[model samples]
Target chain A: MRRLRHYARLLAVQMRTSLTLAVQYRFDFFLEGALALFWLAITLIPLLVVYSRRESVAGWSFPEALVVVGWFSVLKSVLDGGVTPSLNFVVEGVRKGTLDFVLLKPADAQFLVSTARFEPWRILDFLGSIAVLVYAFHRLGHAPRAGDLMVGLALFGVALILLYSLWILVVSVSFRVVKVDNLSYLFISIFDAGRWPIDVFKGALRLIFTVVFPLALMTTYPAQALLGKLTSAHALLAGTGGLAFAAIARFVWKRALRAYTSASS
Target chain B: MIRARKLCKTYRVHRRPPGLLEALRSVVRRRYEEVRALCDVSFDIAPGERVGFLGPNGAGKTTALKILSGLLYPTSGSVTVGDFVPQDRRTEFLHMITLVMGQKQQLLWDLPPAETFAMNRALFDLPRDEADATQKELVDLLEIGPLIGKPTRQLSLGERMKCELVAALLHRPRVLFLDEPTIGLDVSMQARVRDFIRRYNESTGATVLLTSHYMEDVAALCPRVIVIDKGHLVYDGDLRTLARRIRPEKRITMHFSSLPAPGELDRLGNCVARSELQATLAVPAAQVTEAVRAALGRLPISDISVEDPPLEEIMQEFLGGQPANGGVRSA
Candidate 1:
């Protein structure tokens, strides 16, 4: 518990510093906001076109699909806002030997690396996603029950854990591989597949996302919970998958740290 | 309170030639070469002792320091610092020690140094007043009071390094591992850092293990020195003793009132350098007095001084004489 408090305090420091840094570069924030909105529009344009042609695809209605896309947007915003910047820190830390300083600290290395930065401007995407979610709810003309809201929040938390775990797993490869310029691109490409419903994928590809890659848990399961379509077993499965991915991430991080010879020597 | 028995750290590095075909081939069949970073290195540091870890580049000095500070795990060995194994990196152990690398910094680059200090205060769970007091003391010592407010990237390297010291030392750890702490600093800045480190050690009674390519830093701060070359320990003990052991000749330099004949100076000792009216001779420690007298009597000497050979030369000779695989000294 004390360790948790220490990590929390360190994370708070990171958040505060990142906020100040973002504020200093206000122009960059505006640029990032514009970019994020443009990307969101690009993602939604196809959905709008598809819905115009067909009422629904893969059992999900057009408005319901908007909720899925919005929820994904929110999750992606959180990730781009926090984990992306932190991964950059990891990459630079590895290159410059600053990770040695982190390893020397008394705190857990994983916590330090994960919560080391935040990009406040990326929250624009979250706001945009919330706006879409509200509009989609109004168009559907249905209010989620109290139980559904609770399940949605819980599933959202699970999705966050899964996303964070996958990111750490990807970035931790920097310990063994010095050059990680393309690693994040590869990760985002895999994640882009999650923008659609997992059911749309079939056979080995579906199995890959569902069981092996696990991007399905990051988007589809959470959106399913929020739309009141997730069964108790599915919720349990998502939670279990989150826990397993987190454990694997921790294991991989430990192994990577052990393998870290540092850049100086 | 630091001890290591046969501590060894080796790294397996992937090797590939620089070519498109080699890059493709490496993707298919990657080859690795094992480099011994630290081989059977063993040393004991008593509480409050400040020892200079000395070596040429890639001499295992930084490697040993990294292992002792828990930054890297040793491949095989028994190592303990203040009753905790370093590789375990226990909280108490980490809290008790600090490592400062001049090439790398712990400060948040985009934030002010004061922010990092505050962050460390919370991370270390230091009492507010105590942490503040330590910070103030270090800030005053480093004379970085005003510089702390500026973003780290905006500060000069020396200023940033001073702030880095404050961040690392705010917890008042009992053990400090400093690698090239004075590197890239101006002469005066280096001297200031050396003085600050000495004063900190004196005040806190902290044990310091320092590695630096700058011999002046070692000469100023450390009484005992450990010399390593190519992952092996070649010499260990008193700095003066090591210098005398390796380079027994004292350098005698004289400024003559008039030009002296070459053979006249050669009679005094082995002429190391000679100019129109000045000459320098390398005389064995036992013969330094006789050599000086002979030069004074035979030559029109206006001024003369005798001193031990430069530390750099002593180190070069020490490293050059070491046998291959003369692995790190074991206690």
Candidate 2:
């Protein structure tokens, strides 16, 4: 509990530092906000062209697809905004040898590296995603009940944690493979698969997305809860899976710290 | 406050020689080389002691420092800073120590150094008042009053180095591992940084282990030095002793009103350098009195001063052309 408080305080200060930095690139701040919308358009335009002729893909209606897009946008924006900057910190810090400073600090090194630099203005992307999600529900002519929305929020929280954990696991590989800074591209590309419904894939590919890579859980699970299509057993299973992935990420990070072999030695 | 016992660090580095073929072949069949960065290197620094860790480039001084600072785990040995094992990196252990690497900075690049200070204050868990006071004191000492508010990217290298020192010292760390803290600074800035380090040590009684290629920095601040060459601890003793051991002769520099004959200084001692108004002669340790007396008595010298040969000269002789003894003296 004491350690938790210490981390909380550390994160508060990090947030302030990040805000100060974000203020420096005021023009870039607006550009990121604009870029978020541009990203959503580019992602949805192709699907719109497909929906013009066909009503749905694999039983997921176009409006339901919008729900998936909503969840996708939220997760992507949050990842690109708050957590992506920090994850890049890990990659850049590892490449630049600057991480030696982070490791020397009293706080948890992983947390410090992730939160050490950011553009908090990207929170605008998060807000925009909420508006998109609401509009999509309006188009579907159905709004989730308060209790179901709460459950969706909880599931979304787990999914967000799971995404961060996965990124941490990827970034942790930097200790052994210092040149793997570009591995973040792999993360985003795989995460792109989450833009579609998991039910569309079949056999081995379906199994991979739902379980191995776990991209579907990052969006589909949360979308299901909002649609009131989620079962208690499936929700519990997804929550357990998220926890297990988080544990693996933590373990990987610990191993990476042991293998750090900081630069300039 | 810091101790290392037979600490060894061996890195398995992937190797590929120049050429596209090697690069392309490496994709399928990579080569690995085991390089011993630190081999049986052992040293102990008592509380409040300032020791200069010296070595030629890639001589394991930095590897040893990383091991001591909890940044790198030694392959097969133990390291402890204060009361905790360094590799364990316990919060108490981390809070009690700091490592400043001159080549890399801790300050947020786009943010003002003040932000980093604020972040460090919380990270180190110092109370607000105490943290602010320490920050003020360090800023004043370094005379970095105006630089703190500006983006760190805009600051000059010298200015950035000063701010870096402030950030590193804000925690009032008990053990400081400084790696090339004064690198690339001007002579005056170098002197100022050296003075600041000395003052900080004096006031807080923090144990400092510093490594710098600038011998002047080590000579001015550290009384003791530990030198490693090719991952071997060749000398660990008083700074003066290392200088005396390697080059015991004193240099006598005289400024003449007029140029002296070329051979005139040869008789007094080995002429290290000669010019119109100034000449430096390296005289044997025992013959310093005789040489000064003879020069004063015979030569038309205007002013003369005697001093030890520069530390760089001693280091050059000690670690000069010979290939590093990859595995020389065993500690």
Candidate 3:
């Protein structure tokens, strides 16, 4: 119980530090706000162009696919605001040997590095994504059932775990390679595909998105849960899959730490 | 509180030649070379001991400190700190130790140092009152009370280092592994840091293992030192004893009221430095009394003093004369 309190306080302090940093330069807050709105517009343009060509690309209608794009925007906010900044700190830390301070702390080094930085202004993007979700539901002429909302929330958590785990796996590679900016760019490029519904892709691409990289689990499955189109069995599989990815990421992270030869002082 | 038994660390470094053609050709296959950073070196430090780790560049001093602080594992052998294996990095072990590297900083670059201190308090799980008191004490000791509220990016290098020390010590760990803690600081700042470290050690009874490029830092703070050369443990003992053993001669410096007669300065001892106003001579330890007597009688001296050779020269001769595989010595 005491350890739990310690970790909670630790998270709060880390967030506060990041918040203090975020507020230090007032111009950055406004700049980030502008960029967030610009990216949201850019994200919707492709969906608009695709839906304009026909009534639907796959089984998903224009409004239904908007739900997937909503979830994508939400996930992107979490990734950009929380995950990517911290993981990028790790990469820079590895190259500069500043990760020594993280390792010397009494807390788990993984947790410490993962919570090192954040961009609080991403809350604007998050609110915009929620507006998109609400508009999609309004266009459907019905509110989601309470049960569907519960499942959707749970699956949203699962999606976050999957996304964070994949990033962790990418960061673990930094211990050996030391410079992984291109690899990180590659991951970001792949993430761009998550903005589309999973069914739009055929055959091997679908299989890869569903299992290997798990973009389907990250965006499409959660959107399906919200629309009341997902079954319990699929939800169960998503839960188990999320846990498995987390387990694999945890294992790789530990092994990579053991193999870490800190950049020479 | 610290024990290392035949600790060895080796790294397999990737090797690549220069030129775009060589880089393209190396894409097909790469070469690696095993570089031994530490080799069968061992030492035990008692609690509250301030020990200097002396070595030239690439002499494995930082590697040894890293291993002791649990940042790196040895390729072979074992180390225990405060009754726990360092490599295991258990909560208790980490809670009892802290490592600071001068070239790198742990403070948040965009935030004030107070935020970093608060973050450490949470990370170390310290009691609120206790942490506050410790922070207050350290801030006063380092005279950084005014600087902590400013953003770290705005602070000068010396001020940032002082704040870094406060953050590292806020946990009040039992062991400290400091690597070049005063690098790039001006002479006054260096002396202030040294003074703070000595007082901290004396007050807290913590074991400190320090490595620095400045011999004056070592001489002022560490009575005992461990010397490594080419990844070999060359000497470990009292600082004065090591200097005496390495260069067993006294340096006599005399200020002249008038120029000495030709060959007069050489008659007393081997002349080392001679200028128009002053000359220094190296005298054998056994004949120091006779040389001084002869100098006093032979030369017109305005001032005279005798001292051991400078620590820098002693270190140069010690490391320069050591064989590649020199045996370890401890006293």
Query: How does model 3 score on DockQ?
Result: 0.85
Q: lDDT by residue for model 3 over B1-331, one digit each (tens)?
A: 8999898999898789999998997889888899999999999999999999998878899999988988888999899999998888899999898888899999989888998999899999999999999999999999899899998999999999999999999999889899989888988999999999999899999999998878888889999999997678889999999888877899999999998899998888888898898999998888899998988998899999999887877887887853311222211
Candidate numbers sorted by TM-score from highest down? 3, 2, 1
lDDT of 1 at A226: 74
Model 1 C-alpha lDDT per residue in residues A1-265, reported as the tens digit of each score: 9767766777777788788888877788789889887787787887898889998798989888888888878888888988889998898888878888788778888988888788888887888888888888889898677888898899888888888998888877998887797998888788888878888788999989987778778788877887888899988999999999999999998888887778874
Question: Who is ahead in DockQ, 2 or 3?
Answer: 3
Clashing pairs in 3: none
Model number 2 iRMSD: 1.4
- Can you write out model 2's per-residue Cα lDDT over B1-331, one digit (the tens) per residue? 7778998999998999999999999999999999999899888889999999888788888888888888888889888788899878788888888888888888878878888888888888888999899999999999999989998999999999999998988888888889989877888898999999999999999999998868878888999999898888988899898789889899999988776766778899899997878889999899999999998877779999999997776776788754322212111
Candidate 2: residue A72 lDDT (0-100): 89
TM-scores, one per candidate: 0.95, 0.95, 0.97
Model 3, docking class: high
Evaluated against the true structure, the overall lDDT of model 1 is 0.84
Residue lDDT tens for model 1, B47-145:
999999887777788889888887788999878999998878888998999999888888888878988898889778898999999899899988888
User: What is the alpha-carbon interface RMSD for each candidate?
Assistant: 1.6, 1.4, 0.9
Q: List per-model TM-scores for chain B.
A: 0.94, 0.94, 0.94
User: How much does candidate 2 score in TM-score?
Assistant: 0.95
Candidate 1 vs candidate 3: which has greater TM-score? 3
